[model samples]
Target: MAFIGIDLGGTNVKGILIDQSGEMLRQHYLPTQEDADGAWRDNVRDMVKYLQNYWQKPLTAIGLSAPGLPNAQNSCITFMPGRLPGLEGFEWSTYLGLPTYVLNDAHAALMAEATFGQAQHCQHALLLTLGTGVGGGILIRSELYQGLGQMAGHLGHISVQAHDDERSVAGMPGSLEYAIGNYSVARRSHGRFSSTWELVEAYRRGDPLASYVWLSSVKALAVAIASLSNALSPERVILAGGITLADDALFEPLRAFLDVYEWRPGGIQTEVVQAQFGDMAGAIGAAGFARKQHVG
Candidate 1:
């Protein structure tokens, strides 16, 4: 049977067709568009239709991984900040004409990593997606944990700075996202750099201002991660995002600061690592989730 997974983001919509064994057979992508009257729904319908057509047969099911909290009962979207307004407030299955399971992209990312990526076989793991905003997911005993309101893993919104003006997209002050997410980094840059890469490059060149801004963000992440380690005791922490590609620049400082800030009675043993699936995790996880829902 072929299942299709749709990963909806603020900028791009990615869909993939996979078989029972989870091999991607065909893929589709489109930039997200918005309309006050919701024409984007039709565009999405067409995208799914095209994916099905590419498969040359009816899809077994469709699954969606999208931004924000899934409403209780998981029937529709709730607070999907940073997503297009047109996709909000609707049951996706209604528009797509398929059996669809909607989950938070962060949750879906964790599902993918735990099942088929870096955190495979781990009993406890935490995944943080560092993108336009920070996204988080928790895995316990190999199972995804969705707390009440499906908001258990908004790790980016955790308050890290006590005296800062930066607020997360979630409208909370001094949030981890505001400190580390790309938007937050850009905001802190004060237009000195047009892109995150430029700021990172400035840091690479040993520029003091860039160093201060970038390392401060890294410090915030370390503090937040340490704080969480105290509470959850995850075996490993998986950092996934466009920003995580900063490689040594991010991990080196993060490791140093993480060790400095993380406090444990015996010693914090969690290892921080990057995700394996990169950009495709959300779609793959969404597909896996749909397949599980279909089977179970």
Candidate 2:
């Protein structure tokens, strides 16, 4: 049997066709057009059609990894920012004409890691994705926790400091996203760099401003992780997305920061590691979810 997984981002739409054993048989990618209104749903429809034309078997189910909170029924998006404008009222399951499941992109990444990546055996885990923004998902007892109104795991919006120079639209002062997210690093360093890769390279070469920005960024991330460690008390905290790939310069400082500051009764000992699946975690997790749903 084949399952379809769609990872929709602001700039690209990535679709994957995977089999029961979590092997990707085919893949598709398309630029996210800004001029196409309601393009979010349209892009997905196109991808589905494209995959169907390439695959010999019928797709069993479709799983979507979107950027905002999925509605209670898991058919549509409820809260999304300007990047995804028409999603608030779009019915993805109906549009796709398939048994569909929609989850926040971060939540999808968390699911991906928990099912087949780094957190496979862990009962409690937290997955943090640092991209254009910082996004997070918490799993307790192997189930994704969607708090009241399906807005529970908005970890990136949490306020880390009142006087933080970086403030996000979520109204939280010094939000983790504002300080540690990819954009935050570039903005803080006053570099014209387009992406975190440039910042990481500059930091590696001992650029003073880049080093300062990188350290500050990791410090902010550590602060947030420490707080999450205390609040969730998860067995492991997995870091995914582009920024986490900054290597030891980033992870080492983060680990050291956690070692000194995490508040826990037994001396704060949560294992922190990079996500095993890297970018494919979403597609793998979506396929796993589809397989589980098909069996259940």
Candidate 3:
């Protein structure tokens, strides 16, 4: 049997076709084209149609990883704003005509980790997606807490610093999102570098200004991790998304800052690690979800 999954993001739409054994048979990608009218919905239709025609195989089930609060019925997007213009309140199943499951993209990423990556078999963990925008998911006792509003694991909104009057659209000042998210990094850099990668590279070369901005982000994340640890006591903190590609440059300082900041009841250290899977995590997790729902 084969399952199909889609990971819909602000910039791109990615999908996968996977066999029952969890091996990817084929993959697809298309620009989200948030700038183009109706492109978000159209690209998905194209990908699904193209994949089915190319493989000459009908999917057993389809799963989607989308942004923001997907309605409980798994049909409409209720609260994702500034993503795709027409995404909010859109009925996905009606548009696509498939037996579909939709979940928050962060949830899908964490589920992917829980099902087959570093977090497999772990009873409690937190996964943070550090990208152009930050996203997060929580696993407790081996279950993904989808929350009543489907917006529970929004860890990035946790405030870690005081930015005076500055705030994210979520209205949290000095939020982890406003600190470590790619947009925030670039904004705080004041155009010293056009991209976060450039800032990271400059930091790697020991540039003082770059170090200041980078360390502030590291500290803010450390503070957020500590707060989460004190409240949830998760066994591990998993870092995913594009920023983790920085590897040691990000983790080493993050760990050091976490040590200084985290307040644990027994002086225990929470293990921090990188997530497995890369660009494929969202698609893989979405298919994994469909496999569980349809096959298991």
Backbone clashes per model, in order? 0, 0, 1
Candidate 2 lDDT (Cα, 0 to 1): 0.79
Candidate 1 global TM-score? 0.89
Distance from true position, residue 262, model 3, in Å?
A: 2.8
lDDT of 3 at 22: 74
Q: Per-model C-alpha lDDT, please? A: 0.82, 0.79, 0.84
- lDDT per residue (tens digit) for residues 36-117 in model 1: 3555566567768888888888787887888778876565678765556745568887777788888898998987888678
Q: Is candidate 1 or candidate 2 better by lDDT?
A: 1
The best candidate by lDDT is 3
**lDDT tens readout by residue for model 3, 1-296:** 78888999777899998788777889989998878899778998887887787668677778888877888776666888677887888777778887778888998999889877888879999999998868899999987888888887888888877754668768988788888888766579987876678889999999999999998888888989989988999999999989998888899999889878987666678889999989878888888887777766
Name model 2 segments beyond 4 Å from true.
Answer: 38-40, 190-195, 264-268
RMSD of each: 2.4, 2.5, 2.2
Q: What TM-score does each of the candidates earn? A: 0.89, 0.89, 0.90
Q: Pick the candidate with the highest TM-score.
A: 3
Candidate 3 matches the true fold with a TM-score of: 0.90
- Give per-residue CA lDDT, model 2, range 56-130, as digits (tens): 667788988877778877777788877677777577777788888888888888888877778879989998888
Stretches > 4 Å off in candidate 3: 54-58, 264-267
